[model samples]
Target: MTQQVPDKLVIAISSRALFDLDESHHIYETDGLAAYCAHQRAHESVPLAPGVAFPLVQKLLALNTPDPQRPRVEVILVSRNSADTGLRIFNSIRHSGLDIVRAAFTGGASSQRYLAAFGAHLFLSADAGDVRAAIDAGYAAATILPSSGQGEGAGGQLRIAFDGDAVLFSDVSERIYKQRGLAAFAANELAEAGTPLPGGPFKEFLAALHRIQADFPQDAAPLRTALITARSAPSHERAIRTLRAWNINIDEALFLGGMPKGPFLKAFGADIFFDDQQGHCDSARVHVATGHVPYGVANEAPASLPFSVVSQ
Candidate 1:
């Protein structure tokens, strides 16, 4: 049985987010379930390649000292593959030297119900539907996108970035922008500059990370966080004050205004960046690993749900 660490920052990642299962997934999509299972059985001994979130997981796992009585971080594998076909994933984990110990394989079912049981602060997956479900449940979650990042982060420091107005803060302002105009949005922000923006989907997750960061001195913290938002000066005061009001310490805050975020994320050497907008996510994936929050005004589709981030 896997030992539980209740005090640590916990994350749950799906099989496809942890490793590249594109080959088998393609088989499942094209040739159906039987072929997919057969292929998995045939290649059960073959190790899978690392997927987009691998580097981030590696850094998170590395937070535990070599001989600690208890780990500071815990990662649980929550997958859709059945235990029969999941042997390959377990083998791949052993082969890759990853320290992941606990997992929940639900055959072909979604793992939304198990996230709370794992005490997960965050969830990453290739399935947008699952991510949305997790977010709706009030747990922080993101849909992992194809990584174009340089694999390794700056000198082993685990850096994370987030977007504003919809992700870190409720899309209240974003809704104004979409409905009225930029002028009205700016006016409203300036008016409510003293009032803190309501917490968005990621508030609790960020607070948890801040608690971990408190253990180390400012210069030596293992995890570094940045806020890269499209909101520029005049409107920037609200974002700053909102974080201050929450007592959350963000290492860097970039108010790019309307600037493209790809270059900034590349410069930040982020392990993963989260944004609620699809356009920003597409650009960010070119420079670093990106996740789509799919919450708030920016993600609303009148006709149907949006799952294009990693859908076949």
Candidate 2:
């Protein structure tokens, strides 16, 4: 069935990303697997509360239908929980009325291996290790951070926002900026403004989203996307050029030029924002659900680098 739906925009999400399982996770960490299983079994019938990515999942699933030919979205649950303990998650799914029918209950093993089989365009999880594995395996994956913000945009749209460098485009420019400072970075951008930047980890995912968007009338599309990057002026030109070359449409573009992204993302009513920098993710999550994309040069050898450099 999954093979039959190859054209669908499939998203693989972890159970913890879908539900508030903090207490249960803590129990597993402390009392071992048996206790965790016992607790889950004891509370199997009680529906779990929504987690950080819950609202986004809701919106994405709302765009789907039983028809496979038309543009549609499919959400597949990929969890480390064994099917026995995972009954609670399934119960919660039914309780929440999510139309999720495909899943992989991998016991305690990593679920990244199943992502390719399911043809997941994107994967979201709370585990940084799992996210990294998925990224290494070439899927658009992010560690969904805990957040306290409105789940949906005002118009009930799936307003997804992404960072430019490292997240969407390769960190080639970011590495230059980091090593040689802004002056050189600006010079490089000016010199190579015409060249399209290399595709980063999330490029394919963004393109898949664009494909889904192409199915609907422009003004009446069910989903929207924005590029919320720190680049400004000259650097912005290359990003614009790159998106044009890729033929993907980002509904909004905000070149904050290194300003903190919290207020802007809040204003945009972003349901979720993705950035490779932890500091930006930290700031954005205060106002919107944020995902930390731990990829590219920025994430390499982080300890040796200064806090300012890492956060910037």
Candidate 3:
């Protein structure tokens, strides 16, 4: 008998992560599964389209090593489909020239239940429930950004750039800025530079990525992180000192004085750029992958508000 091999990484990706769907169609638009089935029946020649995270998973598959001695990353797809559909999709991917380490389908209505029970190093989904469940399970789960769907390789070190004020730090300072204006917030930052603020929700995710990167020595890590913020001159100093005190080493930092960030992030060849403001993230998408952080503020009426910077 051949020896069994253990996986190096366990990645659970949702169906939406693997297929593409029409953006105009709402989940309810298709009478749920029955409608989807009918549509599939009509388009007999075409399989359900690939999803947003398809490209990212494809890139990940390229990173796998064939050597049995080396750690191997395993990707298991969990979806709300029949086992047969799952296997068929897996086979389709295999035939499409993707060297999959492994694949599976959960065949459950809720992707979260399957993810929690199966457990993986990471879980990816466009569905918030799956994302949240993976995060709750202490996994680095994230929603697939549209740009990440189209992204090719690291393009070099998989540059991940973040804004400082509302992306990495708490939104308290941002609230102060919005309520009292820029000067007041600047003064507070100057004063509180020595004091650590509450960490942002993405803080844990960043730290986890950092730890994974730590597997490589300081001299050679495949991932690089940067901080690009609107904070200017003297104010920028406070952020530097604060991050240093907090022991987070940002690979590159820019203090643009209320200038557009697209140029700089693009110049850096970032794989993903995240900001709380949709405007900034929108602009960053022109050059790289970008994402929006939903605000945790209570009682706030949600709207199609253009992105205003927030404290992450």
Candidate 4:
């Protein structure tokens, strides 16, 4: 009989997202693949410092301790480096004691293609192109951003934050806001307040986390979730009602009403924050670990604004 893959919350992450590989990445971009390969080989014995997602991965792996046979989470390393060049990443993984045994080394090929093969619920990478491709392919993916400080893993709690429209729920409301402005958007939401919003990219991922959270006592569960959005009072009702209809419980919800999300996320001590808008992601990355979910109306090249500015 063959061994079965455990029913776990599967996450596929890039080497850069798992560890700080900016220096190595710079070499590859500037000096080409040969130099990057050589550099990795030369530094093969050196342990890597943790990147933004390190603490999140650490806490996620900790969920496995209660039951070795049926771990709650599974993390897979998916990278563009060839197997030879990947030895350093594996070495660092060993040094850091991360239980990431499964991996796919695509050489210089895009690693996003293998996400579904790994049965990943979420994929995080430093490469924006790969993240965009993954999202286009219908996978829950985000491009990891730089962090202002090290992640908070000392608390032993996994705190995940999500954006509302275009993230947790479909971009329908967002399309109205983008096309007709706030007042019309508000009116639309008000009229549809009772209707449940359709699920978006991160919906399945959140459901998986909820399942893991259910395994532990609510008062003492190691996982905590928050809905941090730009939506305010009148519009917020729809989001709340939608979550209620879906039977999902978010530990916290912040309707900032266009206020910057960075400060709030920092105060929440979020291990990881995901947002569809690059503006929010940029701001939050400076305070906490952030991921850019390039999706919906916000990510589209605006007719009035330049592409770069809209994305920034």
Candidate 3 lDDT tens digits, 167-201: 57666766776556677878987887777666655
**Predicted structure with the largest lDDT when compared to the true one:** 2
Q: What is the C-alpha RMSD of each candidate to the true structure, in Å?
A: 3.8, 2.1, 5.2, 2.6
Error of 3 at 216 (Å): 2.9
Judge candidate 4 at residue 235 and give its lDDT: 91
**Model 1 misplaced stretches (Cα beyond 4 Å):** 303-312
TM-score of each: 0.95, 0.95, 0.70, 0.94
Residue pairs in clash, model 4: none
Error of 3 at 61 (Å): 5.4
Please give, for residues 103-198, the per-residue lDDT of candidate 4 as tens digits: 999987999999877889999999999999999999999999888854463378889999999999999988877767788889999999999999
206: Cα error in model 1, Å: 0.9
Q: Of the candidates numbered 1 and 3, which has the greater TM-score value?
A: 1
Ranking by lDDT: 2, 4, 1, 3
**What are the clashing pairs of model 1?**
none
Clash counts for all predictions: 0, 0, 10, 0
The digit string of per-residue lDDT tens for model 1 on 1-312 reads: 767877788999999999999999999999999999999999999999999998899998887864367678898899999999999999999999888889999998989779988899899999999999998998889999987674346798889999987789998988878767788889999999999999998888888889888888898888899999989989999999999999999999999987899999999989999999888998899999999998987777644533322210
